[model samples]
Target: MNNTNTVPLVAILRGVLPQDVLAHIEVLIAAGFTTVEIPLNSPDWQTSIAMAIARFGDRIQIGAGTVTSANDVAILSQMKCSFILTPNTDPAVIKAAREAGMQTCIGCHTASEAFVAIQHGANALKIFPAGELGSGYIRALKAVLPKHIPLYAVGGITPANLAEYLRAGCVGAGLGGDLYRAGQSPEQTANQARAFKQAWDACQKR
Candidate 1:
């Protein structure tokens, strides 16, 4: 959504608490991350998202992940969130997010799901548990997937193997615990974010 030719790296804050979420996000922003997702499963996620948007909406794109229902989409829309990410390829959720003027990234593990998600107007595809599926799986999927559709590797993604996924044709990735654990200090998270940015930059050079 940043509209750059380079791949977008999403910081996935699964267990971040509202009180500390803004601090962590500031660290991420300083390290060059523009996209961030706070999973709805986190405690008071709505508040975290709202805080992030209110404080730094112009500087970063904040959104909600683990979103499953249209009702959640409506809430995010009202909150003026930038995007919606779901763990599964639910057409209704995708449609709702799109109608609400939010970018949609639907999770998919199989080719069928990927196709269905694309058909439902997903802006991107999140290949979840990508570590288990490997780059080979992505290569296989790429053969059938439209070239314009951006594929993002999520789950178990680390700086070491991120390039491999990129070479396999994935456009981006969702960084979770590898980037920020719930209890990690903001300084620690900033260090990890820098490492990931370096890796992504290196891959782009190749």
Candidate 2:
């Protein structure tokens, strides 16, 4: 979400705990990722986001995912979150975030939704259920959308199929259940982080 034109690679931390979020933050940096998202649906997510910001606010871009209402954006803004991500495009929240000066990644499934997100001033577009749409589907959408708009592939992106998606023209990806498993220990989180980073690294070699 920076001006470097570097694609956004979001590490979706869905089940991480308040105590263990920092540990995975280290893993994410080690694994060549610098963007992190904590979904509000996760238990104690506010604590996790606050703690993460306290530690990695300087180096990493911290965001709140599954944001629905303007209130969620306001809460996350209070937590010092640098970005806001939603599972679906909502103009009200988008307007609030835009006014609050926070970067946003709005989720969309169809061309109409994608366009609406862009019209709402989203910083990036997340193609949810990208697996169902397939990597090739991006080209089809690209044909009709703005060329400068960055596209992130989320949902079903994993270490196993990351290269396929990246090679197909996805600027970046969001890993959900594939990155952070529920009740995982710090060691396990690091392992998964390494695996995903390795996969992304492999894509770079191409």
Candidate 3:
């Protein structure tokens, strides 16, 4: 986390390739994003993550997403990943990630899951399928969660609707398909990243 007041938007490059990943990340950083994740399911994901970290780690936070196992944690730890994003809360995975000195943003959909993730040492909570669940659900969750817990809305998030989640108390969002899609050109990514950055800046002003 950069720790500035700027909303920490995470660029979830779910299908980016190793050869093209850096170009996309360059434009994203230029548009003011400081955090990015390459899902393990993507082609050559480990290589892409390593490349990103080697090139931009000092300038931004780079990590792996859709992580599920402790074995994966060990590999990422060796690479010095700044954080790990999971699709679901798994205590073992969380414990491993924490022990490896990586920030954990475990995904959750209910209060029970949220609390459980927190107890296991998640640094943040990602509300998966957030657009489907809507911001009202996030507002309700925020009410009972510790005030310091940062909530991030993921899935189906876009520039047009980011403010709805923010006003409902989410600190940021994980931008997936709306932010980047497989085969898109670097120019396309630049346009979308700038749009998202502008949207986040606008939301903070309100």
Candidate 4:
């Protein structure tokens, strides 16, 4: 779970292999990504999530994304997930997560949706399909959003333009394909994850 005070570069492992999960997260943690989100849509995602929590729960904020139901929220929280991310706003799911003590980041496309999500107690707002909107869209959203709402760009974040997203007022960002492209080796994924963390660091220095 994220807060307005701590800006994090969230890593989304959309199709990351189980064997690569620990290795990649180790590299990410070393590179300064203390927060990571694994979508349940991945193969054996629950097992992967458990492995991550068991291995790095003490030091890293392990979470699940693509959540759309209260059931997922309950189970993941019971699994000791530190954070939760949803592709869309679900007031009941948000309330359930809050009651379970997990931080919530729900996807929203417009200011009204964002405002509604915030009103429902979302800790952060994820601008889904962020690439489609581009940094310009984020800037427009930022202009109207409450200064206290943490907005993280996801669904197309990468090293090439992480700085641009940050400049657009996105305090944090999340990436899937750029970091964990399919058909890659565990070692290759580890390497790319490290590179991603480096990019986040570079964004921060700017």
Best by lDDT: 3
How would you encode candidate 2's per-residue C-alpha lDDT over 156-199 as one tens digit per residue? 88889888777777778888888887687767777888888888
Q: What is the lDDT of residue 27 in candidate 3?
A: 96
lDDT of 4 by residue, 176-202 (tens): 888776556657666776787777777
Pairs clashing within candidate 1: none
In model 3, what lDDT does residue 14 have? 92
Sort every candidate by lDDT, greatest first.
3, 1, 4, 2
Per-residue lDDT over 1-206 for candidate 1, one digit per residue giving the tens place of the 0 to 100 score: 54673239999998999899989999998888889999999998989999999999887788899999999999999999998888999999998998888999899999999999999899999999899899999999988999999899999999999999999998889999899888889999999999999999898788
Model 1, C-alpha of 16: deviation from truth (Å): 0.6
Output the lDDT of residue 6, model 2.
Answer: 38
* lDDT (tens digit, per residue) of candidate 3 on 30-130: 99999999999999998999999999998899989999999999999999899999999899999999899899999999999999999998999999999
Q: On lDDT, who's better, 3 or 4?
A: 3
Runs in model 3 deviating more than 4 A are 5-7
- Window of ten residues with lowest summed lDDT in model 1: 1-10
Candidates in descending TM-score order: 3, 1, 2, 4
Please identify which of the two predictions, 3 or 4, would achieve the higher TM-score against the true structure: 3
Question: Which residue pairs collide, candidate 3?
Answer: none
Off by over 4 Å in 4: 3-7
lDDT of each: 0.91, 0.85, 0.93, 0.85
TM-score of each: 0.97, 0.93, 0.97, 0.92
**How well does candidate 1 match the true structure in TM-score terms?**
0.97
Q: What is the lDDT of residue 130 in candidate 2?
A: 90
